[model samples]
Target: MLTLCLAVSAHAASPDEPLFNLPLEGVHAFYPGDDPAFASVAFDDGDWPTLLVPGKWSESGVSVSTYVGWYRIRFVAPDDLPAGKLALELGLISWGDETYFNGELIGGEGFFSRTSPQLRSYAPSIYRAYPIPVGLLKPGQENVIAVRVGRHFNEGGFVGGPVQITDREPALERAEQNRNQAAAVQWVLFGIDIAALIFIGAAYFGGVRGALFWSFCAMWATHFAFIFTNSQLTYELGLQSLMVSWVGILLLGVSLYLFYDFYTRALGWGRFFPMTVLATLCALIPPIVFVVRWADWPHSLSFALDLAFQATTTSTMLWSFFCAVVAWRGGVRHAWPLAMSGLVLVVAWMAVALFASTDAVLQWGGIGVEVGAKLILLGAGVSLGIHFLDQSKRLARARESVLSAQTEERGRIARDIHDNAGQSLAAINLKLQSLQAKQARGDTVDAGDLEDALSFASVASRDLRDMSHDLAPAMTADEPLEVLLRDHAQRLGEITGTQIDVVSDGPPELGPQAKDHVYRIIQEALRNAVSHGNADRIEIVLSRQGGGLKVSIQDNGSGFDEDAAMQSDGFGLTSIRERTDLVSGRVTIEAKSGEGSVVEVFVPVG
Candidate 1:
């Protein structure tokens, strides 16, 4: 007969109530069935050697084999041993073990001994449980517990556990609570991982070109796989599976790589090839470790490699934090959310490493941190999604603005050709025709007339040059936005014969696209002030305010109804509004029948 004693809970004792505790190191062992007197209360032979309970004889450096050793404990109860329906719990055991309490057989895990040569070893994952009836324990009395173990490998016998005596009810309740908590966390993590996968899949398949999103999904997916690998159900199946551990090891490696890879991409640092190599190494470690492990590698080597893998994981997390900090410092606002999530997960890992890494029951740390990890990851994903969404919206707006600017540019080019270049060419043609007529009639050609022809040609060339510069200002490439604005103002001033003042206060950095839009808006405003209002003097102001750029162009000219201008906006003013709106900016126009007009624009820096 084989029986297992199962304890339902890990914490049944209160702070003030101490239970009867026994040390395993003081146990005595003997050859099983060597003598029936071994079970007698006073029949301990002086020659019997000591053996530690809750451990193996081989691990204790003793020369022993299967079907030969017996573990016995002689312990005296304290005055406070609980008086109730007490239960005994011996956590997971392997190979074979038979339990004897006070010279009576209570439980066993396998069939063994001289009377029965049959051996039935259960899977290492299964816990052997037996019920201890009430009134079976004596208080304030010496008690003996003996276990006869039969197994040869490290996976056999009582490897890591405690033989505990606990009150049945509280322990059972606690066990149920743990199961419920674990189930809840597991379901939550599964749901989140699935949802994340779906979301990332949608984004990836929807033409998101970046590698960041899918790699991010892989990271989460691999973690999800890792969770099940540590599940007891998986562990049990793995006992009979050749590929379970291998698959798990491979997934573990991939997960690690994806984690680090996603972090690298999200940080958007330079494309460091060596980081990928390092990530590959991280990805390769688990499979290699598992292969070597299956090949009977040295235990210490396996331990060292496993520790290295764990260290790398922690190091990657730390490096991620560092990268996030660096990114934030470099003005990547998206990094803030990553840093926060990383901090939480890092602390969770630290707590898990400190307290729960070696635990067999729940190998993924405690439930609290497990739940915390899920929540942190979920929140991080949401935050990242929002960030990308905002960036996408901005990009779309910028694209629209650029397209509008292109259209306006084409129209301006056509206008310049017709108004300046074409007219000059036509006048030069007229002058040449007149010269040809004078030569045909033998009339004298005037030097003044030649100079006038030369002057018209020069004006055409000047117009072409100015139009080219306006179309694509070389200064726009590297000059500060204020410089570009000043140049535009100077050019407009020359044409209008009006004094134009450009003043810059705290000129904020702006990208080329934004600068183009701003310049065009100001140009439109200046054109209106001159052509429509007939402005004498103009003032342009550029400044930064609240992490944004502000532009104001004012002119002292005859003004018209502001509402009418907005209602029946000319092409130039409409283009100005479109450009401003595309950049998610605000624009205002103030004008009256007599007062000067002011056009003001505000655009965000983000």
Candidate 2:
């Protein structure tokens, strides 16, 4: 018989206790190679060196010869142990491990048959629990347990633990609860990704569409896939699961880069090709990493690949932080959240890289990879939502502005009809009535009276025709914009007796819609000059300069306060600004009291 001494302090057994936590007092390990005889009960490990339990072999005080190691531990069962099937529960084991109870093969993962030792079979970040046979333990007697571990990466052997022996029923119940908790967390994350994807997709397809929105959708979609592959559903896939997860992560990086690319552009920072280059690298690196890892590439090569993966991901995060800060400093809307999110990601990465050896730092700080990831998602979602809402609000205000302008124009048209056409018709009717009265009294009517009636009728017809023309300009679609503007300026000048000059020099070939807006802008400016400014001279210039079309309307009218006009609910200058914005152009108004006003518009062409 081989007797192993465990320096566990004696404690009285209690039947009511749910389980027993086997003390880590006397665990022995042998390094470098594996032997089937090492699992036999008669084999003596007395000469082997002692090691720390509930810890990795690499970190334990003893040195490990190779990637393979064997650990032997002895524990005594309680005298009052329940009369039921028992179980041995160990938390996560890095890479792989095989367990034997009293020389009988019981359970394992990654590490398989004594000769095979399949290291690729590892299941990461999962709890380990194996059922013990009914007669495997003798009450109040010592029991020996042996474990074979194969190290693939990081720290090997039992890297995670609360190693214990317990009743099979209780252990199963606890395992189920733990699994449910883990699964719940995974499902929650998956649901968040789904919700974000749906929102972004709808925004992209439903009118607020842009490159920025599309990239957000893609990022969330990739994250959803990553969550799926990393979840329990893919645990049986072993190494392939990790590969798929990595691929998803890499693709997510690509999406993030694209997102910032468009985001910066929207903020008026222009596009940076380096961002595109990083995105391309992220897109191309995944396949190579996947293939090499799947082919079981040399450890050093694999390490290099891992290093590259980390490098790209970290670089992407740093770049995101840089962009966010720059945007915020530049007074970009919806930028603060992005900056906060980037900071969180950087902090999380630092914590994982520097303090991953222990859980204490993450727990105490209440921030880790999981927390940081969720924060980032929250920040992004909030940012997108705010932008959408802002756009919708602006759109609503623009619609109201347009409706107000239409109503005011209709009022002006009504006033013109009543003042000009109505009065002329009334005068003709009065003259005819006077002619009938003179004929009734036997006095002949003068031919000059008939001529006066004809003149009044002609005036009415002209005013009506002018109103019709104002409703819709009589011009073909192919007509140049300058021709239409000059006709409008001439007509307005003929009516108001103002000297109007329209100088055109290489006017831009804007689309029909843009031309309409430009025409309306000039018309409003002219009307404002005639009515508000009471100016007698106006000059309109159309020219091409600096890759843009410049429309300058200068009037020697009684100009009002530009600031006050912009601040008020007036329609003329406001309409000009809104129309310019619709076509992605800029408008500037220079005016002072009793001097002159200059309204200049710049619209990018080509």
Candidate 3:
């Protein structure tokens, strides 16, 4: 009776035989007879392989193998079933496979395989999954599953489970729902990452280190996007799947190098370039191998190269962790977030590496290490966001400090003028008034001494006025360039007793900042012409030049050497240069030992 039962089971549902009678619309379970060889074989939930019914494969003492041939299964649908479309769900396949149902071809292609170390190595590729649609399976009739799987040197065959059936509507609905949920989660994480990346990029670019830091950040964001898309959450964007995977590895490598440069510069640690280059070369491994595949290289070589690439990536990540630690030790004000983010990313990557290297972890618990990787990426994004906010606040404080320093400097200068020059001028003015009163009363004072005192008072008064002008120029107000320049020239002429000629034309109005710079430049130029050039006559000319205004102050005096004047120990000419620079203006000074000096300044009015 046992022999008869065994024979009945072997040929019970051969390729041409009908399936056991069962409900057409619900789930059913099929279990192969207890073969000791099947005990060690298990399905990869990470990449669930499909089963073939009514078939068995020979196995090595260790595991099942499907290298020799195809496997087939037969089932019969209920004849009373509705006429709607049907589906044969093949959970997953290993390496590659082709499926046929009812003597008609069904969809088949390469699915993500966790069996290969390459697929399992990365955090994004830990999940192995594929779906084949068996459309219109002729409900309530005999159906056959013929799967041709090719495996080499290892236990393979259909190691997963038998096929199942369901109505097309509910099956499609569930599949779509799963896809949507995955996409939503993936995109939410991606959006947060992108926002953090943008903030970091903006802050890095705005700071003193300039575009290099931002470039590193931008590349990092791109790499993260590629990784996110390749993850199990939304790995089905079609052609982009393989491309993004490869590109992500490449960009991650490149970004590591860039980050090395930026980190060193921003943090003042300059010894990390060598390690960065080594890491970059490691990142290049995958793309190189991919390109050389057309050469028909040995599979072992390709595998070795892939391992090397991963090792390099791992090393680079480790180096980043080291750099972060060093930065933290160096008292880098913003190091905490970056260091923590790097540490988390490294930990996440290491988790994936551990799982890929060992099969026992996957065998014991279905949950692979990729979940940790996703969480790590999320954490890194948060860290970056916090870092950017902190940096922005620091910049604001620095700017405030600079402005306060400028205000204090200006106040000190004002105080010095008041205490020394201002007080001396007041006393001189009082003595001059008393002397003039005595002279009018016929006191018979020496006219020469009286003249000398009057001259001293006048000189002191002019010095005080010049000091006031230097401390706070009148041009800071909403005054026109024409008016300011005219007033400045008159004051200079009166003080220096020189022939100062004033001329003006076209566009009396000027931007306030522009006018202020121009007035300061003119003031400096006139002072130089009077004190240094010793010119008896000075001509101040203001005229229109294109969309700007030009003011020329020429003195008929003993001009000094132009080059010597520039290199000399004097701040007057330097101050003129600085004033012109502030307004984006240009200044030209022409002078020689015997020739008169000519100083011209041009300022954009708009």
The best candidate in terms of TM-score: 2
Better of 1 and 3 by lDDT: 1
Candidate 3 shows a clash count of: 9
User: Distance (Å) between predicted and true CA of 227, model 2?
Assistant: 1.0
Clashes of each: 5, 0, 9
TM-score versus the correct structure, for each prediction: 0.51, 0.59, 0.45
Q: Comparing 2 and 3 by TM-score, which wins?
A: 2
Model 1 lDDT, full chain set: 0.64
Candidate 3 lDDT over 1-606, as tens digits, reads 323433443343233322331322222222222122221213212232334332223232212312223445556766666545555544333334445565445644443331222221122112112233434465556565554443322223443333455454544444444344444444555665666566565655656232334544654565565556444444353443445555655665555555444444334343455675766676577566644432434545665675676677677767766766787787655555556766766666666555532333322111222333334344444444444455555445545555544564466466656775666666667767777888899886677756766676676676677777664755576666676666766776776687778777665466666666677677667767787878888888887663467778887888888777767534266556656655545578888787988888876543
In Å, residue 250's CA in model 3 sits off its true spot by 3.2
Candidate 2's C-alpha runs over 4 A off are: 1-27, 30-51, 57-84, 95-124, 133-156, 164-166, 197-207, 236-268, 279-287, 360-368, 403-576, 583-606
Top lDDT prediction, candidate number: 2
lDDT score for residue 36 of model 3: 20
- Candidate 3 residue pairs that clash: 19-76, 46-128, 47-128, 51-161, 77-140, 77-141, 78-140, 79-140, 535-557
Model 3 CA lDDT for position 45: 21
Per-candidate alpha-carbon RMSD to the true structure:
13.7, 10.6, 17.7
Worst 10 residues of 1 by lDDT: 1-10
lDDT of 2 by residue, 1-606 (tens): 001111111111112466555544345555545777878877888888767666765467434335567888876777887766778877667667788998888887654346654343215444567898878777788777888876543356676666888667666665555454445455555666777777766776777665456556666666566555545555544534444555655655555565455445334343456755765665666556555545545445554655565566567667777887888887656777878887997788766555544534322222245546656776777777776676666656767788877776788787888999988999899999999999999999999999999999999998888777666743334678888777877888899999999998887688777777787788888888898899999999998764457899999988989778776554378888777866556678888889989999987553
